[model samples]
Target: MAASSSRSFAEVQRRVSGVHRGTDPEQQLRFYDGWAPEYEQDVTILHYQAPRLAASCLASAIQGPLADALVLDVACGTGLVAQELQAKGFCRFHGLDGSQGMLESARRKGLYQELKQCVLGQEALPASSGFYDAVLIVGALSEGQVPTSVVPELLRVAKPGGFLCLTTRSNRSNLRYKSQMQQLLDDLEQRGLWEKVKVQEVERWERATSEQEAMEGSDYISGVVYLYRKAQTVGF
Candidate 1:
């Protein structure tokens, strides 16, 4: 799909809705693989802000030299999060995504030291324990996307005291999923797996895509960015 300044909301909504209709991980991967080329453009059309917001949340929580931080970007998706982190002075990045096409698109940017394909929830993250200074997964934790169970893998990959940043939509459509995910995060924190650093709720996460939201006169969807630091020692 070619870039079009004149692309309407209907087109963007249609594409987004198509991906949502995917019944299984394979179907979702196929949809994303085919959309990879146009993914950035479509998100740009939606004014997607989770990548930037999550990156910023992680960057602020990082303690040492930004350039030395080995960041693992989960569901990297065309390197949008890496791009935002790079703008903040972080250098090394390792990206992972389920779609080969999406990984290829990220590779073209030459921002990552490594890139791999791993379908979230289905496979273990191909990263060593306690290896990353920071790990982030943006735009992947929402309803019908990655499940909250994957949070453990994210925690496993981060160094003790390293940050883990995640984002999810807080709009009406995602409210139940968000609540469940939030419970998991809170439980982890209670168990000393990690501690909360910041949690920000933004009213304008992206342009509203559903007709129900439009009917409700909402122009943008809400989202939350969650930042947490891995515990240095187990409390359990």
Candidate 2:
């Protein structure tokens, strides 16, 4: 193993973990803006797989031609998820995020046809109900980021018969958040909002070999990708 590679990975992991521990919006946005230039590089070092996992899951479940579908990617930092989806035959993409720096980097990739700025959970989403054929929000459904309440907004943007995909980490620190998210999904299902399409529990979500995270019994973190199909006859 290279010494320089290991040192660089550790530094990125520490910063990534630190970003999740705070509840300050401005501070988090500033941190991401500063980290935007090297963000893709750092996540690649972490072996982040949520974007790939989410795209694969959504692609397999969609019934129509992916190229004809319009996708809305929320919290689309650097267009990673859109890039993954585009590889799976999805062509049209619209993205939203809170960071201008990150969106600028994403624009250079040419994945999204439109990119808008919105502070999720606080600001109203700038989309009509049932507008998109597919709605995706990867890597932003965590506790210190977008609140669990935003899940409904994700559901709202999708067409009545469209798909909704979301991903989140499942580490020791996120136990309560995960539980709450699960409960919300269950309640929405019971209320006839959307039915589950698939739920994939990912074991190798990322490589965070830091001593603090390793105490969870492994050098890696786990995550889950949840896919749902909205009801065609009713809105919930």
Model 1 bad stretches (over 4 Å) = 1-6, 214-217
Off by over 4 Å in 2: 1-7, 215-217
Worst 10 residues of 2 by lDDT: 1-10
> On residues 5-44, what C-alpha lDDT tens digit does candidate 2 reach at each position?
3338767867787678756877777777887888887888
| Tens-digit per-residue lDDT, 173-215, candidate 1 | 7788899999999999998899999999998888988866442
State, as a TM-score between 0 and 1, how close model 2 is to the true structure.
Answer: 0.94
The C-alpha lDDT values of all candidates are 0.87, 0.85
Candidate 1 residue pairs that clash: none
Give the winner by TM-score. Answer: 1
Candidate that scores best on lDDT: 1
lDDT of 1 at 94: 99
- What is the total number of backbone clashes in candidate 2? 0
Clashing pairs in 2: none
